[model samples]
Target: MLYFEDLTPGRRFETASHTLTQDEIISFARQFDPQPFHTDPEAAKTSVFDGLAASGWHTSSLTMRLITASELKNVANGLIGMGIKDMRWPQPTRVGDTLRATIEVLAQKASGSKPGFGVVQLRWTTLNQHDEIAMQLETSIWVARRPTEQA
Candidate 1:
């Protein structure tokens, strides 16, 4: 299993490409986030975004997959979520735009209060096949560290 020691600051990890489907987008939006831009394409066209766009939550969920496939799950410290900080959807993700995620480790600090755990801050950026950035996220997660005995 991967451990906290395995995470290197400034390191980056990427995920396989995936295309967002219109049906899937509508499905998710209909349930969790029902907004004009997310649920109705014609309304979205008249709205500012031009067409149907995925919710930020949906984008976040996709980002998690990239992290999981990157083996972050194995390295997490009980998988504690610290919440997102800055998030921006620069470009609307269309149904056919192939999407990929990349994560860059920004910081790693052993928690002073939580023994045997470390806090990791990362920037997760999602891009399309054309190399255009679609979403930007700042995520903070806890990672289990090697016990003192092992260290």
Candidate 2:
């Protein structure tokens, strides 16, 4: 179980790879973004992508799934996402692309109002098979601190 004390600034964690499929990309985009480049291959050929691509939101969701399945699920007190900042999708995610995520602790501070919790700022970077960054985001989360031992 990971506690707030376990996550120090500069610490990094990685998750297993996930391969993107055309069906899944189209399905996700159809349900959420429904953009031409994300939903239709022929249409995407005329767009800037030149091919069907996963929606930015879909990429973020995939990143979250990897983090939760491989990392966050091990947290002792769990985590509550506070907010996100500076989110960007630098490269398009296409079918057959295998993606992985790296999470780095940027900063952390014990909550003044909530002694039992701490606020942790993290930078999440998702990379494709070519190791090109597909997405990046800064997020803040509340993590429970380990109980202090009494003397």
Candidate 3:
């Protein structure tokens, strides 16, 4: 299991790709963000996206899934989010788009008050098959520190 001491600034990780399909996009949008552009392909043709688009929330969810199920899952403790900042969905996620994510450890610092944990700042970039950024965000996570061995 990876501990806080194992992480450093500039560390990077990549996740496997997942192809978004029309059915899943429509289903997810129907349940959560039922915008016409996301749920109806016909209506979407006239929308700003010009095609069916996945919800930003859906893209975020997929990003989380890729991260958790990737190499980052080796952390001593499961990924526990502390906070998020500067989240942006720059481009629409269209149907049949293959999505992948890359994570960069932007910074890390031991917690002053919480002795057994540290805060890690990470930047997640989710890109489509065309290498266009579909969504991106910076998040802080709590990582467990390595236990000190007694002499």
User: After best superposition, candidate 3 residue 61: deviation in angstroms?
Assistant: 0.3
Q: Name model 3 segments beyond 4 Å from true.
A: none
Q: Mind giving the per-residue lDDT tens digits that candidate 1 earns over 88-136? A: 8888887887888888889889889977788888898999889998889
> Compared with the true structure, what per-residue lDDT tens digits does model 2 show for residues 1-151?
8899988999999999999999999999999999999999999999999889999999999999999987767777665899999999998999999999999999999999999999989999999999999999999989999988999
Off by over 4 Å in 2: 149-151
For each candidate, what TM-score against the reference? 0.89, 0.96, 0.97
| Residue clash pairs of candidate 2 | none
Candidate lDDT (C-alpha), each? 0.81, 0.93, 0.95
Q: Pick the candidate with the highest lDDT.
A: 3
Q: For model 2, what is the C-alpha lDDT against the true structure?
A: 0.93
Better of 1 and 3 by lDDT: 3
Better of 1 and 2 by TM-score: 2
Candidate 3, residues 69-98: lDDT per residue as tens digits? 999999998899999999999999988999
Least accurate stretch of 10 residues (summed lDDT) in model 3? 1-10
For candidate 2, the 10 contiguous residues with the lowest summed lDDT are 70-79
